[model samples]
Target chain A: MNIYLRLVYRNLRANLDRASLFFELIFPLFFIFVQGFGLNGIVPPFEIGNGRVISYSLFLAAGAVTLTVINGGTNAGTQLWFDRKNGMFEQILMGPFTRAQYILSIIFATLIIGVAGSLLVFLFAFPVLGASFNPSLSGVLTIAAALFLGTVFFGAFAIALSVALKSSETFQIVSTFAFFIFLFTSSVFFPATSAPSAIQVASLANPLTYTTDIFRAGLFDAMTPTVSLELGILALEAVVMFAIAVIVFHRIRV
Target chain B: MGVNQLSRLYGDKPAVDRVSFDVERSEVFGFLGPNGAGKTTTIKMLTTLLQPTSGGANVLGFDLKTEGRKIRERIGVVQQQDSFDQGLNVETSLDIYGLIWNVPRTERKTRIEEVIARFGMEEFRKMPTVDLSAGQRRRVQVAREFIHDMDLLFLDEPTVGLDPIVRRALLDYLKERVHKGLTIFFTTHILEEAEYLCDRIAVINQGRIVQIDTPENLKRRFGSARAVEFKLLQGSSEALASALSSSADVTRLVQDSGTGAYRVTTTRPESVIPEIYRLAERHAVTVSSIYIAETTLEDAFIHMVTDDENGRETERGLG
Candidate 1:
């Protein structure tokens, strides 16, 4: 446990600086801000000024969580690529550690980033965007559960992808393709009911969709499917992705 | 820990072909080879970084194939490439290493402090790794291994960018650590490193072990005697060769292109110096640079490996 925590600390300290204001927070938060700017442009000015402050804020918060899972996974995935190129992957693999510890370190590190990234996004959305963070006591609990499970799914997917990629170029190409799938199919851009039937079906299969929708529905009582169904999908995705990640990482020779 | 007939493949070619060796308790075994000769490949197998192709190996008596988890628990490794989190200070980096090893919290602080002190790194402990020079970073890499006394320590080209003084310091540190009952397995390309530090040397070239022997034994068997050279100053060759030939102390003979000097080889070096003076007196030829010399290790290495035809005139490389 200490080892895993130390790994997370080292990763955070390693990437503390950035070139833009967005660097102060995770990529998910930055993306949510961008989405808010888009929302402001599309909707009338009164929509924000009206009593829908909690609605707008929750919308932004769900986007933040979705962005969190996606970006956290991709960023953590980059480590293995760099390690392979620099020969450090072999170095770490050769050390006196169980494969479980090595995998656990990476998983825990990324999950923390995922959770923190989304929460920071939610915080920023509440104040600057003139939105309310208030919710029922159970609302907060459900959001935490949804976010935690979502992290496991995305984090596992990232690890498995990192190992499958032979080169950095391939990883980037695939990550871009998948990021779009996450963006358009999931309820990130708008509510699933508003999406086309084909888009709605695809969103149902996307774990990020379930994760984001559940947070919005449970936390803000926003338009959503049954909360229990969304939670079931998120948990299933977490289990499947974790199993795949374990198999792929175990097969890695260096 | 043991490795038996370990083999590894890179594509179709075997990078490490059936390499088998044991790292005994508290022993410092040197793995010496030229670049691309598979030393790193062998280390990867023993450390469980790469699974063997056909053969199997063990570390701390754990099977590398099935019990890889157990194998990792008992050893330490230093890779050729730097992998310490460069964002942190030297001290913090060592702390992370200890932390990953699961060193206890009560002992972690003391161990980290001791490591900084042990490596004479008190001043640089607070400085970021990015600011340090290559040698300083090397010190941190090495210190990470000693932070806790693991069963075996594997160092792959540990002294690659260091200066002579620092290289010696690192070698001495290994010696000291070995005296404290630590076992080490290291790989290096520098021949002098093998000569100075290894109990026995394995010279690998082009993915094969050319020879493995103690430096002294190799020298005694393959090393040639010294060459004798002298100047010819307006002296008759018939008289000089005749004067040198009668004493029966020399063999291979050649004349110097400049100043008509003569060079010869002989087994009787001690007596031959005095005979050179008598020959100079008899022939009245100049005897220049006639000091008795001993063959160096480089000469022996070249002589041993050169083809048979080249072996006859192996002295040419030295002369």
Candidate 2:
């Protein structure tokens, strides 16, 4: 109920109705639809010895929520830079809230929007992927937590960029660059097991890869490692990224 | 907290030099300066947007360097440029601002309507900001400052491009807010806005405050003071010049009417007037019409700022 918290709340709420708002919310869903159902006819990544034609669509759905989290950071951070360029940043700076509050507000708002998109992905995953894989309620909860962590981590990434990039053009370039780094390199759209030996090691090192692997493990019984250890790794990455973001935010001029 | 000589610099030159000012309980302080005069720079420091290079200030007694959050909580700011989300309607914009402070649902609706009415944006409540006119959008931007109560408000060029009617309304609203016990700091290029609205003003040029005073006091300080114009029945330049030449306080004298009258410019009018009377009577010149004129703020501003002693200086060469 304090002004700082209230300010954060108001900022996020306004973001909900923006054009970027719908795009941030729906972009992940699009990724899910294309990767899930639309990609059924693609021939690559096909290991046919098992006598089964697999649908990667369901597998893609499992990663939707986590992808949205990363997008949240990039989109929100880019928008912040745009606002600053337009002089709107000065208006917020003149208000009675700390920079930390401003950053936290964006992160929290993105989390909500991220979750909404992810929940839709979760429901879609169940029907297309052929029901529960016995990961249990705890496993399901574990995946949700991982997705949330990934979302927060990326959201922080965006805030950091927004604070650092003074110009809207610079922000766009950085966000675009960061998104590519997040995609292809991560295990979101590809199986970590089969990626190039070099990329496999990098994927393991990537936070998004861990998030996708953690969620994929919950959806498919084929995952080798237990969900607990994967959850630990995701949480650690989230904490480190989040702390760095806060420090970066505190260092900003406004 | 009072702003204590807060300033900024770009590499070598100071964007704002050691500038100091204090706001008490409910005063409306106007910062009058031309473009790039450190008006925005000073406000940025006060609002904790930019850190000071040499001197620092406080807000509501909170140290700007260390306690920015405390300051941010107790003040409202309207920047020089409009920054509202173009995607949102007027009604939604207020709701979002209110939500930022976490106002309760019941109070938010009423507050939104009240602010809309106060800012005269009721008709545009459901209209997207992108669709509104420049003046309407500006009204929304200013209206954002009123979503909730705050101890102080900072307005940076709040009425730019606004017509006289809307500008007056905005000024009146600001006055009302100050009357309700809110300390308001506003910046303007328009001298009339400062003259009519500001309780006290600080005029800055090239990142430094050249003068700070009431408009009247500034006029007196820089203006030509008493202006004596006389219609001589049969006066001569030699007689008037000789009579007024002995006065040390007179700035200048012009005897160009050719009708035997003089327009005397002086600070010591009391002495000059008597000299003029005696000179006229001694010369037997009949005095027709004589009147003394006072100085104005515009004249004072032109004298001190525009002139820079001669009205053209390095700082204003191209501007």
Best by DockQ: 1
lDDT of 2 by residue, B189-301 (tens): 78788888888888888787788787778876787655777777665657667767656755556776556567666666777777778877887776787878666565466
Candidate 1, B287-316: lDDT as tens digits: 655654455444345444443335435757
Go through the candidates in order and give each one's C-alpha lDDT.
0.70, 0.73
- Per-prediction DockQ comes to 0.38, 0.36
Candidate 2, B14: how far from true, in Å?
1.3
Residues A50-109 of candidate 1 have per-residue lDDT tens digits of 133344434655667566677777766765565566454665666655666667767777
Model 1: fraction of native contacts: 0.60
Off by over 4 Å in 2: A2-8, A17-57, A221-229, A251-254, B103-107, B225-294, B306-319
Candidate 1 clash pair list: A96-B72, B1-B60
Candidate 1 chain A, poorest ten consecutive residues by summed lDDT: A45-54
Stretches of model 1 off by over 4 angstroms after superposition: A1-3, A6-57, A82-87, A127-138, A166-177, A222-225, B105-123, B205-210, B224-319
Native interface contact recovery, all models: 0.60, 0.71
